[model samples]
Target: MNILILGSEEDIHAAHLKKSLTEKGITVDYLDTRLFPTKLKITWQAITHTGCLIFPDGRKWDLADINKIFWRTFGGVNVPKLTDSYQERIAVNDSMGLLRSFMRSQPEKWVNSWEAYEFHKEKPLQLSLANKIGVTIPATIITNNADEILEFSQAFKDVIFKPVYGGSHTQFLTKEHLEINRMKLALSISPVTIQEFIPGTNIRSYVIGEKVYSAEIRSSSLDFREDKRAKLIYLETPEDMKKQCLAITKAFGLKWTGIDWRFKPNGDFFFLEANFSPMFLHFERETGCPITEELIQLLTS
Candidate 1:
């Protein structure tokens, strides 16, 4: 069986996965989305139900021969430098749309299908599903209304705000932030997600199939992603939490995922969010977890 990795060449995680899979004597193909339609060629025939992908290096892969795909990241395709920015934007959108449709057509072949990732990536949807599955979640409000936000803030002494989409960092809503951005809030055009601050040790659980590798993260920053001083230590997965994680993975139709939770002093756990394509190099490097090996097994299995 052959595996295809859909991500950028510069991605370290992708590089690790490819190297490991290759070392196992598995046939692997790499496709960088950013070079689509320019350095790569895709041919498909609806009547024959056949498709072919030609890589930039002149390697050819038949769709039927590819047993699995690792959809890591779908970066923007490179477009010819154009004087008209709108045209370039249109070209990018068209390329993405075409690729998405093709991937969705073969959802069963993806590690975590593109359709599942798209559906679960929505924070509100995932939170609702988590709550239904008996996972504790912090009180969250997604809104653009200034009055509503002010009222919501009254319920919690501390709250954190983040973008509804494409936000990599989290920030606390301090008095200074409120006062300085009061005008901007009043005129806000986009909605933001605000959640009551839950204080505790951060736990990152990397779930691949039935295996779970967890790490307890201690960080001084509000968002651990920005905390360079953070430390990681592997923790044995709790029986109940392990079941819940598996349930969540199945619910999202994901074969692999990274789940983040906050463990309160009282031993209560609060669900933060699920990462479809999580960065696992840090955890593996710090704790020596066999994440990449597990990922390869999941794909090949």
Candidate 2:
């Protein structure tokens, strides 16, 4: 069987996956998206329902021949530089439109389909879907207006905020954050997700098909990822939790996912968010979870 990898060698996770596939004697194709529609070419024909990936170095791949794909990252396509502004706009539209079509076309081949990956970017929608499925989510408000955010701040004793589309680390929504000029400029540009901060242990559950593996993340920092010394402890997956995770994964039309939870000392946990492209080598090494094995099985099955 042949598998295609979208990310480049610089991404350690993608590198490891490619190496493992090679060791197992699987033919793997590399398609570094950073070079697309510029340094490389993609051709698809509706009549034949086939295409080819043409590399500058003369390597080629038939789309029909690839059995599966590991879309680690959609590392954006770089448009070729052009002196004419209008030409640049046309180039951008053409490249993006074609790439979007290519990505969404072969739904069965992608590990987690493009639809799932795109929906994961809409945090508010994610929460709503999970909530409808009986998952308890943190009390939250999404807004771009500074006044609305300031008003929401009054309701909670402890509040935290993070970018809706995700880039920066989570932080406390203090008075300094509401200072007029800074927030007005930023909020006017993009919205943020303000949530009632839940003081609980962080738990990460990985769901591959119907199987679940969970880890307890112990850290002193508000955001455990910022803490260099955070610890990961393996946890047995309760039967009910396993079913819930699988439901969430299916609800998002995903083959696999990483679901984060806030586990309270009182034995209750709140769903935080589900990640479409969660890094897992560290989780595997620390928890002794056979995530990669399951991933390979899923891809090659």
Candidate 3:
């Protein structure tokens, strides 16, 4: 089976995955989206729904022959440095649209299809589904009104804010931060997701098909990503939690995912969110997990 990986050349995770797949004697096609239009071309037939992905090296692949696609990153198409700003924006938009259509044409071949990722990327929707599945979730609110946010914060006493959609980092809203940024909040145009702060050990569980590998993250910073002293230690996931993680994976139709949970001092785990295209190279390196191997197996199976 031939596998296509969508990501930037600079992405370490993508590079490692491609290397692993190649080492296994599998055919791999790496598409750096940033090089779209300039170094890549798609000759798509509307009627037959078939196409050839042309590379800059005079090579091509028939879309129908591609068995699997691993969408690690949907990087923006590169626009010329010196060009009309308006025209550059238009070109970027058009290129992205064309790429989206190409991926949608063969939705079934993706590890986590764009459709599924779009649905699962909404924090509120994912949290609701997780709560319905018997997973414990923290008290949360999504609002654009400053008054509503103030009320929620007052009720929770200590609240953290994150982007309603994925990608943006999470931050704890301290009294000082809120006081200083109160005026800016009122002028905000988009709604924000705020949740009650849950104190505990951060646990990241990676679900690859039926296998679940977990790690405990220890850090002093509220957002572990920015923590300089962060450490990862592999751990065996509890049986009940594993079932919930599997259920979540199935619910989102995800073949692989990284689920975040906070193990509270009270001995209960609070579901945070799941990332469709999570960075696993760091986790694998730290814990020696066979994540990349399992991913290759899943793709080639």
Clashes of each: 0, 0, 0
Off by over 4 Å in 3: 79-94, 166-169, 180-189
lDDT of 3 by residue, 1-301 (tens): 7889998557889889988899989899787777888888877788998987888898889999899999898776776654688888888888888888888888889988988778776779989998998888999888777767777888976799888985678888777646627635642767788899998899999999899999999998888998877999998998988999999998877889999999987778989998999999889999999999899888988
Scanning candidate 2 in windows of ten residues, the lowest lDDT window is: 237-246
Model 2 per-residue lDDT tens digits across residues 74-150: 87789978999899989888888887777777999998888988899888999999999998899999989898888
- Worst window of 10 by summed lDDT in candidate 1: 178-187
lDDT score for residue 198 of model 3: 94
The TM-score values for the models, in the order shown, are 0.92, 0.94, 0.90
Question: Model 1: per-residue lDDT, tens digit, 1-301?
Answer: 7998888668988888888889999988677877886898777777887787888989888888899999787775777777999998898788777666667768888988977778766888888898998888999988777667777888998999887775669888877656637736643767778899998889999899999989899899888879889999888987777888898888878889999998888878888888898999989999999998899888988
Q: Model 3, poorest ten-residue lDDT window?
A: 178-187
Candidate with maximal TM-score: 2
